[model samples]
Every structure is written in structure tokens, then in C-alpha cells.
Target: MVVAVIADIVGSRRLRDRAAAQRMFDETIARVQREHPLADQPLQPTVGDEQQGVYSTLDDALAGVLLLQLALPEGIEFRYGLGIGEIRAIESAHRELTDGPGWWAAREAIETVHARQERAVPTARSWIVAAPGQDEGMESRVSTSNAYLLARDAIVVRMTERERRLAYGRIGGLSQSALAEQEGITQPAVSKALRSSGAAALLDGLALMTGERS
Candidate 1:
């Protein structure tokens, strides 16, 4: 099964400078493309502030989403929709266009998130929807995936900017001492920040997302 990821900037219309936000959005997509080699294709801007991409596996797609979220500037946030199914690609001279059940399902998921946001649902940033009849166990898989994203995004949304920076550094394989040096803090202080900010829990959650742990 192929996983499709579609995301757009949250509250993008409210930004005082729309051009700067668009530039940052483009830069974030470029960074994700450069950093995430597992993506089926580099994420491309679709319409307005939205971008789309495909991944060979759900785990890789989720990882790429997390990377993109963490790479953005402090004031920027994104909502993600992940769908698992078959994708049909239409190749053109300029770019490869994609359609099919996968894209449709992803659109549905993103729209679901948007609706939740409109209703003021807390921590409703990421969602997953499995394509209909994709598998006999699709229901179970969708439930588990959405549960994971809900808990993951809930924790991430509560993180302070410094906490997010530490989490990003830790995920990139930086040691506590290395992170301390980068942050100009003591190693003990870094440890305190990680613990207090729930970075360890976030790491564990990411491991579960990647199927590296139960």
C-alpha cells in the first residue's frame, strides 16, 4: 500500500505577511525533500498553501511529516492528512501528477481535520483515513493510526519552542551533551529540559510510529 500525505499551513490566512509565510512553506517543503529520501517523490505545492507527496510506507510518511513540522519556524504550524491506498500517477513534461483513491482519501482526512478545527477540537492537527476496501482489516488499521496521530499531535502541540528544538535535535541523533553545547546550556540543564518538556515521551511515541517499538 502507498501512503499519501497532504498538509497545509494552519491559520495561514491570518498571517500579516502572506508572502513570507508562502516562502517559509516552500522552504519547509524543500527541506523535507532534501532530508527525507524515503518519500516516493518530493513534496510539491498543490494549491494555495497545501502540499502533497507519497511514501512507500505509513511509517516513512509519518516521519517525514514530523520532520517538516519540526523544521518550520516558530510561528508556523501545519495540519497533516495521511491516507493509505493505491495511487495513480500521470506523468507530464513539467511534473508528475497523482490521483486515485489514495489522494481522495487524503483529501477526506484533511477536510476532517479542518472541520474539527472549525469546531474548536483540541489537538486536532493530524489525521489518517484508509481507502475503502483496501483490506479486510482496514478498520482496525485506521483506528490504530488515528489514535497514534492524535496522541502524537497532542503532545507536540503543547511543547514550547525550546522544547521542540531539543526534540528535533534529539531525533536527529544529537547527544545530550551535543545539544547542550548547541544550546549553550549545561548537559544537566538539557536533561532537565528534555524531561520537563516531555521530549522522552515524544521520542517513545515516534519509535511507536516507526514500528521500532511496541
Candidate 2:
């Protein structure tokens, strides 16, 4: 089965300048493609402020989504929907269009996140829906996967700009001391910020996403 991630800007219409936001959104997607480069179908802006991509595994898709989320500029946030299943069709060649249960599930998942956001729910930015009958334990696995995403997104949404940079760097495999050098802060100060800002917990969650932890 393939994994798909569909994401859209949180408040595109409300933004003062749609053109600038679209430019930033496109740039963020390009950066993610360069840095992550794990998607089987590279992430690209499909329409307006929304983008979609396909990955070989759930871990890669989750990693890509988090990286893109962090790569976004200040005052810009996006919600994600992840799905895992077979692709049934490609509606367009040049546009890399696709039609499948996987895409449908992803669309449903993103809509769910949007509804949650509209209701002011906490940790409402990401959701996953594995295609039915893909496996006997699909339901249980989806629950566990979404539980992790909920906890991960909770920490992510609350991080300040500095904290986010630290978390992103750490997830990219940088040590605290290395990040300190890069951020021009003392090692101890970097450690303190990471601890206080939930970066440590977030990294652990990322490890879970990457299957580096039990």
C-alpha cells in the first residue's frame, strides 16, 4: 500500500494577501521536497493553497508532513490528512492526478481535522485514516497512529518560533550542542529551552513516528 498526505493552509482566504501566502506556501513545499525527498510522488502544490504527495511508507509521510509544517513561515499553519492504501487510478498525467480509496480516505481525514479546528479542538491539525480491509488490524493501527499524531501535533502547535526551530533541527538529527552552536546559544541554554518547550517529548514522538522506538 502507498501512503498519501494532503494538506491545506489553515486560513488562506482570511489572509490579507493571497498571492504572498501562496508564494510562501509554494516555497515551503519546495523546501520540504528538497529536505525530505522521501515521497514516492514528490509533494507539490495541487491547487490554491493545498498540496498532495505520495510516500512509500507511513513513517516517511509523517516525517514529510511535520517537516513541511515546521518549514512554514510565521502566522502560517496547515492541516494534514494522511492515508494508506492502493491507488486505483491516475486521472491526469501532467498534473500527477490520482483517484483511489487512499485519496478518498485522506480527503475524509482532512475534512475531519478541519471540522475539529472549526470547533476549537485542541491538537486538531492532523489526522490519519487507513483504508478499510487493508489488514485485519487496520482499525487498531489507525487508532494508535492517530493517538501519536495527536500528541505530536499538540506539542508542535504550542512551540514558539525558536522552540520549533530547535525541535526541527533535533528531529533532523542534530545534537543539542550542535543546535546551540547553530543558534548561537550555550549548550546548557539550548538544553533548557528544549526541555521547557517540550522539544524532548516531541522528538520522542517523532521517533515513534519513524519506528525508531517501540
Candidate 3:
């Protein structure tokens, strides 16, 4: 069986002070536990800013990732590194994977995100999967640049943003109102346009134009 490791931050330090950050972390931990009660997994606190988790399947890991991403409290975001490998159970709920190329690939994935984050890519929300010595597609749900771009389009449609001067802003342009006015339409029409396949196609095109895939 394949094991997946996930690591990510729990809250917003830049936007919150020590007290608020602690509260956010506690709340995030509680939320993750509540969401994965049946996983028999512990969401381990990492360093002072992040959390770590392990799962036995791609579905579990991916579900947990999507949940954490969507359920994250305001001002909080996450980055993830998922690696698949062999494991020896330490207990019914815990185990340790043999680490090597598999582990390194996972680290590289995270490092790639880190580098992109440093360059301010898509607000640094990223995920990676690795299964060394096996088929590459066995690890990542998004196995190609096209797949990744499609996922990005989905995210663009899913999230409502107010921040400007970001890639997302550039993708759809200033705001719904601005786009509406520029197109000589109502705000609701602009929203409808954003919800249409046209917006998705536009995002895909922008992704290609901007070289968003990695």
C-alpha cells in the first residue's frame, strides 16, 4: 500500500498577532480533527506555523487537502507536499515510511512551491505528489501541465477575490464591476460571465499566455 505525507501551515501569521495566531491554530487543529475523525490520524503541529498529516490513500490525502483548503479560516492558506512510499505501521494509527528518492521528490515538490511563492505565484497555494520508482501519474492527481491549468481554472471560478494587483486580478481583470462596466453590462451579467465556460477558457488562455503551469 502507498502512504502519503502532507505538510502545511495552519493560519495567518502576517495578518494576525501571536494571540490571534494561536487561536487560529487551535481552531484549525480542531477543524481538521473534526473533519477527519474516522481517519484515526493525528494532525501534528509542526514548528510554530504548520501542521503535518499522513494517510494511506490518494483519496484520503486529496480529500483532506481540499477540505483544509476550502475550510481554512479567513486569512489562512496552505501549501502541501504529498509523497507516496512503503510504510511500516508503528501503531494502528501511525507509521513511518522508508525515506529516499521518494522523500526527496516530495521535498523537491515543496521546494518548487517555495520558490514560486518567493516569486509570488498564485499567492503560493500549491500541492505536489511523488512516487519514485513507480509510474509518475500514480502520485499526482494533476499529472500534466494541462491538468494543472484546468485545476487552476476551477479554483479561479470557485474563489471570490477582492485583492487587486495579483495574478488572479490579471486573469479576470480588476473587478466584477470593472469588467461589467468595460463590457457595458450589469454587475450580475459580469458575474454570470465569470461563471460561464468563457471565463474558464479565458483562464486557460491566460495560463498559457503567462506560463502558469509547472
Residue 49's C-alpha lDDT in candidate 1?
A: 85
Prediction 3 global C-alpha lDDT:
0.51
lDDT of 2 by residue, 27-138 (tens): 8777767766877886667877788888888878878788877677778888999888878666675655578888888988999888887887756799998877777677
Q: Write the per-residue lDDT of candidate 3 for residues 1-214, one digit (tens) a residue.
A: 4434445552345654765755665686567557454233545665655555566665455545544554455565666665556544333345453444444555665666656656746455555556556665663444653245336534643454331112233342367677666657787766665555344454554445335410
lDDT of 1 by residue, 1-214 (tens): 7989888889887899988887888787787677556687756677888878888888787777777776777888889888888888798899767788888889999999888767867678888888888666777767887877777777778887778878878877889999999988999998998888777887888887687621
Query: All models: lDDT?
Result: 0.81, 0.81, 0.51
Ordered list by TM-score, greatest first: 1, 2, 3
Name model 2 segments beyond 4 Å from true: 91-94
After the best TM-score superposition of candidate 1, give how far the Cα of residue 107 lies from its true spot, in angstroms.
0.3
Instruction: Give the CA lDDT, 0 to 100, for residue 112 in model 3.
Output: 66
What's the count of clashing pairs in each model shown? 0, 0, 0
Clashing pairs in 1: none
Candidate 3 versus truth, CA RMSD in Å, comes to 9.0
Off by over 4 Å in 3: 1-3, 10-15, 36-42, 88-104, 136-146, 149-214
